[model samples]
Target: MIKSIGQLFFLALSCLAIAILQFSFISSFPGAFNQINIGLIAMVFILFFFGIKSAILFIFFFGSFMDIFSFQFFSFHLLVLATVSLVVYLILENWLTNKSLYSFWVLCLIASVTYGFISSILLFVFSGLGGGFSIFSLYFWQSLLYQSLWLLLVASLFFNIFVSLAKRFKPFFLEKKGVI
Candidate 1:
């Protein structure tokens, strides 16, 4: 129990740091670079490796941190993240049973697309209803495209490196001896 708590604590800190870096540093980049959505990528990674329980906690911290920095209404970031997480979790639990790099990649792709679309839809709706800005423009689509590409690239690189080092993710194979 203590070990689990420690792990959760560590995850929270790391997630918080990721949120800060995402808003403070990554968001400052020009054009498509700023649309990378490292926070969403990190959340997908957590969901893939740490299971839904840890991922729920991660979403809470990371989403809350992001909401703090966002210009939209409170909890907007959290809502988008939670929605994406739920969709990924359902897909992972129901369809994708294999816990391999391929599945992780698929989840990352799904999460990225889902996050972009959901956030855009919400922004559009909110702007229609009240004070938010419109998102139905070329920049939105371009950002989504760039975000998906960046997510897949980063996820593939990280998954490969981590899989190489983590024995748990390595595939098991049987060696055949002489005819028995």
Candidate 2:
């Protein structure tokens, strides 16, 4: 029990650090660099390797952290992240059953797209209340496209490194023997 608690603490700490870097450092960058969603990428990584429970925990930590820093409505980040997590979990459970690099890449793509779509919808709804931002503009689509591409690039790199260092993702080969 203590070990699990320690793990959760570590997870939360790491999520907090990622959120800080994402919101403070990454978001400060200009153009496409700022469009990269590190939180979503981290959540997808946790989901693929650590399972849904850990991923949910990560989403909670990361989302809450983002929510605290964001200027939007209360729980905005948390809501969008939870929605994305649910959609990704459903996709992994039903359609993408394999835990391979390809599946991870695909999941990253799907998750980014889902995240962008859901967040835009929420932003649009919220904007009706006060804000003046438009979700259907060309800039929004461009930003989403950049975010998805960056996620795919980062996911591929991380997958390759993890597969090399860990046995979990090692491919199994069948050996054929000649009959004597």
Candidate 3:
């Protein structure tokens, strides 16, 4: 039980770290490109290895953290994060193969894109009341494109680090392979 709590605490800390970056650093990218959302990417990282409970905690805290920084958005981010996290977890947890560089690449790309669209959609609905948002605006496309680049670059660089850490702890969800 203590081991599990330790893991959860580390996971939460990681989520908070990414949330801080996503809020202050990534959003300062000087254009719509910042919408790639490193926080959500880190949340995806949580989903990749952690079980449903940890992923859910990470998502809730992540969205809440973002909300704290955001103005007038209330729980919109939280709702979207939870929904997307669940869907992503369901698909990836079942279909994903054991750790591989290729899976990391594809999963990162997919998670980034999924986050982009889901958050955009949520924003669109909320902003539609004020008639100020456009789902197809050029900014949307630019963000999606640029964010994918960021996702690929970051995931490539960090893939080994996450894998190595997972190897050390062997989190609850990762299946233990048999030794020959």
Model 2 TM: 0.94
lDDT of 1 by residue, 42-69 (tens): 7888788878887789888888878888
Which one wins on TM-score?
A: 2
- Candidate 3 C-alpha lDDT tens digits along 78-151: 88778777777766777876756677677777776777788777777788656545566887677778888887
For candidate 3, the TM-score is 0.77
lDDT measured at residue 168 in model 1 versus the true structure, 0 to 100:
73
Identify the superior model by TM-score, candidate 2 or candidate 3.
2
List ranges where model 1 is wrong by over 4 Å. Answer: 1-5, 130-136
Worst 10 residues of 3 by lDDT: 166-175
The list of candidate 3 runs beyond 4 A from truth reads 1-14, 165-180
Better of 2 and 3 by lDDT: 2
Structural similarity to truth (TM-score) of each candidate: 0.89, 0.94, 0.77
Write model 2 residue lDDT over 1-180, tens digit each, in one string.
999999989988998999999989998999889998889998999888988998889988989989999898878999998999898989999998689988998899889989888888888888784654546588878998899999999999989898898878797877778843
Look at candidate 2 and tell me the lDDT of residue 165: 88
| Cα RMSD, model 2 | 1.8
lDDT of each: 0.85, 0.88, 0.73
Which of the two candidates, 1 or 2, achieves a greater lDDT against the reference? 2
In candidate 2, which residue pairs clash? none
